[model samples]
Target: MASHVVDDTALAGFRTGLAGDAITPGDAAYDEARTLFNAMIDRRPAVIAQCETARDVAEAIRFGRENGLEIAVRGGGHGVAGTALNDGGLVIDLRRMRAATVDPRARTVRVGGGATMSRLDRATEPYGLATTGGRVSTTGVGGFVLGGGAGWLDRKFGPACDNLLSVELVTADGDTVRASEDENPELFWALHGGGGNFGVATSFTLRLHPLPVVTAALLLWPPDMGLDVVRAYRDFLEAAPDEVGGGVIYMTAPPEEFVPEDMVGKLACGVLVTYAGEMQEMRDVAEPVLGLDPDAEMATECSYADLQCMFDDPPGYRNYWSAEYLGSFPDPAVERFCARAADLIVPSPSQHVLFPQGGAVARGPAEYPIPWRRAPWVVHPFGLWEDPADDDRGRRWAREARADVEPWSMGAVYLNFIGREGEDRLVAGFGPDNHRRLAEVKARYDPENVFHLNHNIAPARGRAG
Candidate 1:
């Protein structure tokens, strides 16, 4: 069926019914509104509904469906797949809905769907409370939690969805619903790793934990030492406490004050050790790596909120990212991982990272669909570069990295860290059993499969309209 063009009268009606702006092409803000994190995605949505409330979202979806326009949901626009925007369709942009209401006494925080990690982190920081958030401050809370969130605090508090208390959503039928343990329990379970297939999450209420201070220790060495450092780091993490978290990253050395002049802007390896407690305890925990004779090191105690944004990726770059969960990272696997770093595009903002998992993450609720949590390690190649000509090279680097570690892969992976691979990979993100269960939930709430943008799970044949 061919998509029908939205007429002026229908567009006018949608514009009139919204409490926010309905941006169209030729509008002054259209270009700025359509831009996402990856500059490679140049899509032109027929209309950009900058929704401010849940009702605005409902109106946008209804308008899109009635006009035969594909619907795209834009949260913080951090997804590498560019699923948040579509070509010549309707975009339900939620960037205007940022709000964080903290219930400090109850140890819960309700965040708007469009709210970013910074919004939620800053809101709870003053109360000395925090939750697991994405590595960067700009990631959307809805996408992160709904898609199995992971971050520096994950090893301590578990993935972000583990802290999920409730979700307020606007379904495909334009009905407002709430999913929680006590309400719509099945839908709530599906929301654990279901992505945006069921509905548009207008807000999410998450459980928070007490976190007064966080210590971050960054130790850097030349690229040649990566193999030894990775081996020692793996040994240290195997016996490390739950409060100890962070990753081993291989990237171009930054030209910061602490970095030696010779190593600046050159290929290098670094280990970031994040401790959930005070600074002194972190130093004690990170001593194993520090003793390796790092050429440069910076360790400091800072608020968790501030640390969240420490490595935020700069926008306006072409990006291609992929991941493989490993059952084990033995010496040979470490060698392959480090050797692949040579293929990385240096003099750019790419990172070949190895993250350890096995604390609250591995011990998190087994019922949730995030099967990758059991894996002891993850190899993530996040490729970001400025030149458009580097697009093929960047994508090949990420693909080759996944192939390099394929032998050790556990067959389960995190969907949030990757782009569109295929349907099989989607099922791999959630095991086949969970896929069937979530498909039934998709049948119940969004039978039409109207929201099929992010890691979509199609409704069962009989259930789909």
Candidate 2:
């Protein structure tokens, strides 16, 4: 069936006064206008309003309501589920609102919702500083923080949401409000890991941290060493200091300058490790795993910003992501992880990843909106395919792999890893109590549930009038 298109003639009177670009379906720039980071998701909204200011967002909300159109708010469009796009809806694009104000002495940064990781990292790196951010430099800070971002320094620091000091958001009713622990405390709590249920966040006042000089690198192990590698990793992480962070992925090794071409496309285990502390302590920490195989190369010191980008696969790749938290990595689960990975590799560049948890993630869980505070690790099946024909194949491999780990799971999923298939995962992301509170906040600020585009949280059904 052909999709509905809201006529440009209908919006003609509305577009002229706004400070941002509004593209309609037939516009020449419409194709690029609707593009996002993930290639697997393809949807075109009826109108794309590339908003440059909070006022533009408010105007977009007003327009969508008056026109009876659904709304999708795009920050960095790095969401695994492509929540940034919509079919037959209106998109409020905040990409142009990229300004950032860093207060280094105060150890804080007030960043626009549209700011990218590269933008944030570059702005703070000069002072040897950083905030919790995604591994990819391209990830939008807004979406990353809102969904409880875990990055290279997450073990040393906490999740991004934990560092957030305040947020400026535009409500579903075209009203702007500032949320923080001391101010709108309820809304602030909900904003921490609440997804986009409450509103379109315009900016964030996030706490920053000092970056320690560190050794970080990808330790590649042959496919035959998967068991030895997973075992060594689990053991090393147990005694590792908070300054150390790592995640292991079963992947097809790349034929890069650092990787031997003879091993190109060879199925192997790649451990992305980052150690932030004194160089001597870093060497001692890595010695055990480096001793496992003489082929395990020693890591080199790199800046925190560079280290974060080291493992993030490039954007525009066709991919599917499914994840669950693990209370512990038992012997059987390790065997299952490696065994199932061998069978689930769909095509080129797919990775079965196991990210270390605990450390700062488990600290002060009572202060954040995230659930699954006790989980010690996260297991994600990242299905990547270069062939469009292999879409279904890639999806099935990810699903079957997830099934393999279901029994070992901690019954919680990361909000960022969720997409359209995760509508129910939203409730699972936050616990029933937090979800209920978020729904109440939704009812108070947006009684009609105007922001329904995200992993939707329907209003508390509202109070009895």
lDDT of 2 at 411: 80
For candidate 2, write residues 152-212 as lDDT tens digits. Answer: 7788888898899999999988889999988899889888788788889999999998874
lDDT of 1 by residue, 1-465 (tens): 234577999899899999999999899999999999999899998999999999999999999999999999999999999999998899999988989999999999999999999999999999999999999999998899999899999999999999999999999999999999999999999999889999999999999999989999889999999999999999999999999999999988998999999999888999999999998898788788879999989888988999998889999989999999999888889999999999889999999999999999999999999999999999999999999899899999999999899999999989999889998899999999999999999999999889988899989778754
- In candidate 2, which residue pairs clash? none
lDDT of 1: 0.93
Q: Whole-model Cα lDDT per candidate?
A: 0.93, 0.81
Alpha carbon lDDT at 143, candidate 1: 92
Ten-residue region with minimum lDDT total, candidate 1: 1-10
Error of 1 at 453 (Å): 1.2
Each prediction's number of clashing residue pairs: 0, 0
